[model samples]
Target: MGDDHWLDLDTSKYPFPNTLWHIKPPKEIAIKVTVMLIVGIIGIILNSIILHILIKNRWLWSPSNYLIGNLALVDLITLLLCPWFMLVRDFYQQYVLKHFGCYFEGFLQASLLLTSVGAVMLVSYDRLAAAGLTPDARVTKSAAIKLIVITWIASMLLSLPWITHREYVERQWADYLETFCAEDPKVLGIYWHFTLFILVWIPLGLMVVTYGAIMWRLEWSAKKLSSKGAGMAVSKAKTSAMRIAACVLITAVICRIPYTVLIYWRNRLSNEVNSVEGSFDAMWFAANYLIYMNCAVNPLIYGFTNRRFRKAMDRTPGIAWCKFGSWCCVYPVYKRKRILEVDKNTEKVFVIEGTPRPNRKLAHVIKNILHINKETLDFSVKIDEVTTKPTKITPLKI
Candidate 1:
């Protein structure tokens, strides 16, 4: 097992020593790359919209929503940066970005993912407090900002191994150079296990406990309401809350658990196992797809599931236009008339006819008419009549 021993082997008959350099079938590559590109692009778009909505709406600037906004931000960055490297790796059958890319990509993905997990956990706890089960757990705006900052810092520090342990190694094959990003295998094992604990297990456990407590409290409240003959209303509310909680928990497990299992399985196998074998490769692609899908699905789960978020989304300008089209259009002008009695003593009726105008302009018009009348007597004015006449206008064609 000398450094050059691989060189002595017949290149035509032997495969590369590292599975990272093994190319998959072109068809497989095309399908996987295309699928990833779609998911990544969709995730980027969805997260961007979510982030924009959060930033634009002043009313949505609550502590819990700040955590949600942070989640969208993390998902946006992850979808934007990490996926390109992954797609490249998938297509090239090796780490093509060389040394700097190895460290940067790994660190970026790890930090963003951990940050997302932390935000989701915070959101769950925030919801628990909002449910009034743990009123003390409610956070102020300042405290929420602090928590976000701490989460990011912790994520980066925890992911520091990605920067330190990565090595971009190149080996000269018989006719071509084979390059792959290597990590300290022992460190990788420990790091991934730790990552799984933080990303999957801890969050999952917290969600179960947090949502469980909220549900229990809701059930108790429903029971109390049952005595008051409002049980049906409370029951419906409880069911809706349970449905949302179930969706959140189920999505987390579906998106994350497969990837965690894949990592665990890989780590359990011997180092020499071919990672690009058909079954394992398919599993890898499927697992990663689900992970990215999670990023896109977050806005739908957390945003649409929320009554306030749904209201805000409906109120968003362009969104209403998109949804209802011509129905959102407003009449720019309306034909209006007002009849006023200048004086009860004189029985003089003054009529004003015009399109609806601002109060100042209408007042100026009235002053002009009064000045023309040349009546200097102390006069009492009264709004004798007000009416709107419909005017025909062409409908805007979409």
Candidate 2:
């Protein structure tokens, strides 16, 4: 078309306030986008449910669960950000973000992604450690948070090169000079290597090592226990746990392998042929999204594989309420905790005795699950929990 005719054609509907950078999406690509949006929403909602279960059931806050919670939190952040970037690229087709905006968002996103993978690895390691059945020190709840913090710091440190070379630049396209945020092509190789190593390889290695060892350990233990005439229940539980670990690790590997392979392929082709984007196709776009599926599907795996988690989810109100309902509860202020133990029906049950809940009515509502008779409980203050003050136990209501 001639320039004059092209200019005369409706240009008003093409720019910002008039349009939200809405390019008419092709049918096939549009379908993929719609499906992604639906899945992303479901993942976020389900993860939110997991968060609610974790919060309400204070008893579930063990070190391993803490890691799981952290993973969920990071994946939630990833799901939120991934679509945003996709929209920016798909709709605007330009970097609307200025220099600092680009840098900050990029850094935060990379760190969150790295932290999510790190959290998954930590969860696997915690499980492996737990299976040791040794009295040696175990990872504490606080330690899990500490490890996540370290991962965040490491992610930022590793992503620094991307930030340092980042620029908002204008490039000539078919008919326009498009602006976008990106690393300098000169430093792209560096960024790619760092991203592949830290974001993919290292985490995958740890997950494989940790979960693999757990699988081996559990198999050995099962054999030994069977020989010792141990009940099948204990062996079964370990088997289930091993299966859970394997599922998580394998799913992560499968989801990420394509993305990683594509990245490597792109780099190799760049060396032999040219920039991969020059030949960008639907497969490339699909591969880009493939790794993100891991984040979206992880909660499904947890819900499916773990019986207790499934039970709690079942007990939770409707799925919608459970996922996004935590905001409704005005949680009490964080306070130091002291655990107390009571001998009950041959099982040693532990109870969370924290500073009184802000809502006085619910303060004595037993927070931890324990099977015991109400009569034997000592309502009168017993031994001082942290101090010498006698502790008071409230009656368990029917």
Candidate 3:
């Protein structure tokens, strides 16, 4: 807050030299903060469940699943780290954005945001590959891993400008908090703007074209599938794929457009022919929340669009919230959650009959579960009654 010791809302740099910006009323600020708390918490829970399901089922580890897992990982990190700090800053009326918090938020945000968008794009591309657009007609597991590694590296590079320009300083206007996280606008502003363009616009364009092409291909393929049984299977897969693509595309656009537009609007405010100062603050508040809201809804998209995902979620969160009536009851079990396996010949049969021992830890539980990634395996835990056994036993890979 060297500029004025105000809460840093721009998410670009903190403690800027400009202290002339409008201030929000306490009531309005409180409302926005409340929404953030709710969304951030929900996002964390849902994304974690998604990650658990992805991790538990070893047979599910394909190229598509890898992208899905990467996505959940990024979103989980963002929901956990970014929103918590912002909520604290807003709720407490703190003028100081601590140095580490200020610098790290933008750094992590930029990297995670890029990784999220890149992942969605990867999923779209993989669908195209699966639909016979490429010679292999599938993304090899090795190639998918390489692509994921490349994405994280690229995000780190893209977000480098923020790290280099950040600073810790005393707030000029407020003495309540001695130091705040600030950015050196002169050093990083231009690069931030350029990278912002590449981050927001490039993905918007790609998603639009990629999803459109996928729809067209779906239509073309539907005609070639003439036999009823094979045609039905093709139809189901295509329909499910397109539904997911559409939902992801829509959620990303809806959440990102406002924030991107508002940032653009503020940057262009001086060039405006009319007075638009008052609404800018409100719009900025709304736009930022929109972005936050985007982080929260991927779980909803997955649950609604994919039946297997829905089933997997049902095995954890659904079981926790619906059957047990409280997440606290589900937490201990999910924390030590193990694999669920069924034999190829039998249906609805679980491999084990007792709950995981709380004292016995296994490093390979998540590893084996993820590697054995089968979506259709019955995860319904049924224990032998009147015996010293619990229903939810962690299964070893068969």
**Best-fitting candidate, scored by TM-score:** 1
Model 2 poorest 10 in a row by lDDT: 332-341
Ranking by lDDT: 1, 3, 2
lDDT of candidate 1 vs native?
A: 0.74
Q: How many backbone clashes does candidate 1 have?
A: 0
Candidate 2 local distance difference test against the native: 0.63
Listed in order, each prediction's TM-score against the native is 0.74, 0.68, 0.66
Give lDDT tens digits, candidate 1, residues 254-358: 998998888877776653435446577667777877888899888777765665665566567656444421222122111111122322344444333342344
Prediction 3 global C-alpha lDDT: 0.64
TM-score of model 3 (CA atoms): 0.66
Greater-lDDT candidate between 1 and 2: 1
Tens digit of per-residue lDDT, candidate 2, span 1-398: 01224323454444421122335357755776787887689779767877877887776777777877777888887887766665455444456666766777767667777777777777767766887646465788788779978977886787676678776655443445446575565676667767777667877888778777766777787788888777475677666666667777787777777767767676656332114333454446666576667788887665444545655665565653443232221231111111222222344333435533444454335432221233225433333212353334444333
For 1-398, candidate 3 gives per-residue lDDT tens digits of: 12322444342343333334234568867787778889888888777776777777665576788887787888888877777655555444344567667777778878887887777678767766766487676778899999999998998898887878887665443223334456676766576567667656777787777777777777667767744334665575567667667877887788877777776676566633223446875676676667667767865664334445554554653344453223323542454354222333454433544324433346667645653344223333222112443234344545
Residue 226 lDDT in candidate 3: 49
Candidate 1: regions farther than 4 A off? 1-26, 273-276, 324-398
